[model samples]
Target: MVRTCFYDRISEKRIAAEALARQKLQEALDAPPAVIEPEPVAVVSLQPARNELTVAGLHLVMPQGFNFRDIDTTLEKHGHPVTFCAKRRPAPDELTLQRSVELYVENLRKNYPDVTIVRQSDRLLAGSPAIALDYIFTAGQERRHGRATSALINAVDGDERQWFSISTIINPAHAELADWLIEFDAMLDAIAAN
Candidate 1:
């Protein structure tokens, strides 16, 4: 808990700097003076519609009171690995679902060379073929594992087909949150075609 009873105006410096940065960002967005790289998570404020969760046309019947957050890759530049990451990438029509899965897994291999996959499976998501992978890795002296779900969301846009992924890792210190894992699996199983 942070105490509000700190120093004088000097204590507000950090807050003021953050606010100024936000203002500058807004100004830049308004002017469109420079091109900004598209963020991985493009959707926002995923309001529940009819007790279902939808993002980028992918729908899921989320359970009551369950919570999930969209991952922000921008934070990775600030030294934060996206706790839950999701991304959509356009793929050629010739790419088979199995081939896409293989490509994604290969990219993960290049990124996390030390990771060891414990479980790998394929399933259907929203009526589209999908794959799930569970892997473990050592971070510092702590051993941690993560689960990821990938599905091909057919031609979400007019251009080409797209594939999406949702991956998350629970901090080893808070490993008791097994319920979160159960909810995630249930949600994945509840996916429906849009």
Candidate 2:
């Protein structure tokens, strides 16, 4: 009988211990979850600093990565390079902007047999009348995209007329083409004949 009572007491204690463990587990499962805080992020701007420079008697502003070459007649961006060239000279007699653009495209086609004109239109650059042309061509094994803007402006003294052509060329597959175009448009907007 003593052995039976001792066994009963142990079974009761075991049951009580199991019940306590289950109660503790249930309480833990019902409790709210802990939340973690997120780390802060740093903000950075993608636009580069702009600088004002004159090229081929045309005053304009360009991003800081561009370097002047060919006696300040050409501007070239270093990384993902884009080339810009400008030429100013005496206006040709009886040469209209349309004819000039046609002749320019004709010359380009002669040089690059695979040249394709993508767009051509009349536009304004820095409030001055201009003809804008966009074209694509294969140079050797790589494809190239280009834009040319031609305009006529009075000389600084306002007594003589001069014609100017500003051209830019780059690879269409460049990863930064969109950004480069934005910068290019900004530069065109800032152009002024000097």
Candidate 3:
């Protein structure tokens, strides 16, 4: 599955510079002695919303008290190969998802010789974070899963892809936790493996 997300501060720096440059340009264009005041920088913070657990309709449904770090640990403990290494999603027009997928596959092969990589799809679901994560999970699983072992490539944005590999490497006694985790592991494996 392919998905896209944006950083809250993506445009902050660029916008500030642009505003200052515009102010200077206007000062030069205007009659002498025109006062040019810089505009205050706008600050945008990305506080995970209360509903952040569910993005774009995909419910992360992490266990109670679960968080990204906790999930990361769980996957690692289960022998699911994953890495939370990507920085941020890129703009659509910046680069194609195919390019990102290719890079991901190449890098994963170079860095992790023991694993396999597969591009799940070129398609992407453009929506909120929840939706994107959900698509990432489903698409990764559908295209890659084979005999309980598979690596998936899903687009996180036009320029970035999430990688992971899924397996029955886990053995948990708690049915509720295990069932939920197998699904989550698939998602993580898809992103982490790459």
Candidate 4:
């Protein structure tokens, strides 16, 4: 009888312990989840300070983000960026700005598929006659817009050559296209002979 009572007591204690564990588990499940906050990101200015650079015998005031790559002789800015390149190339003395632009557009149409000319007009760059051509074309899956400006620089002492500068703003199909174009035009306006 004593053994039976002892066994009964142990079984009761075991049942109580299991009931206590189940009650604790239920309480835990009924509690609300803890909230987590995300980390903050740093904000950067869209228009940074400007920097003056001399490239291909032209003085240019470009934004801080533009980088000059010597391999291709191009100044490029990444992340919704603008690409500017100026080079002196040998050409016939009779090559006018108009003719150079016509040949450029012809080559562009042949190379790029679905070329759409936006505007082509005569403009003055650094007191010299220049031609500006704006166009849009498909590059891979993305549509790109670019402006090409060309001028024939006649040297007083040396052989005459053509001064060609092309500025292209990539991914201009978004909301920031107008702002990018404005910046590009300002950069072009600031160009002068070195």
lDDT of each: 0.64, 0.70, 0.36, 0.65
The lDDT, on a scale of 0 to 1, for candidate 3 is 0.36
- Candidate ordering by lDDT (highest first): 2, 4, 1, 3
lDDT by residue (tens digit), candidate 3, 1-194 = 65334553557767888999999899888857767897543222221111134445787654555323212222343444322222233234444444444554465456444444322532212111111111112222232221122222234332433322222323233333345434653553333111
For all the candidates, what are their Cα RMSDs to the real structure?
21.6, 16.4, 22.9, 18.6
**How does candidate 3 fare on TM-score?**
0.27
lDDT of 1 by residue, 75-186 (tens): 2212333266765565677877778767867887887778888888886555566788888877777666688887766553345456667777754455355456576678
Stretches > 4 Å off in candidate 1: 1-70, 73-82, 156-159, 191-194
Per-residue lDDT over 87-106 for candidate 2, one digit per residue giving the tens place of the 0 to 100 score: 55566668777877888889
lDDT of 3 at 186: 56
Best by lDDT: 2
Off by over 4 Å in 4: 1-78, 156-158
Q: In TM-score terms, which candidate is top?
A: 2
Better of 2 and 4 by TM-score: 2
Please say which candidate is ahead in lDDT: 2 or 3.
Answer: 2
Q: How accurate is candidate 4 locally (lDDT)?
A: 0.65
User: For model 4, what is the error of residue 22's alpha carbon versus the real structure, in angstroms, after optimal superposition?
Assistant: 99
Model 2 TM-score, 2 decimals: 0.58
Per residue, candidate 4 scores C-alpha lDDT tens digits across 108-154 of 88999599999988875554677888899888898888887776655
> Quick one: how many clashes does candidate 3 have?
18
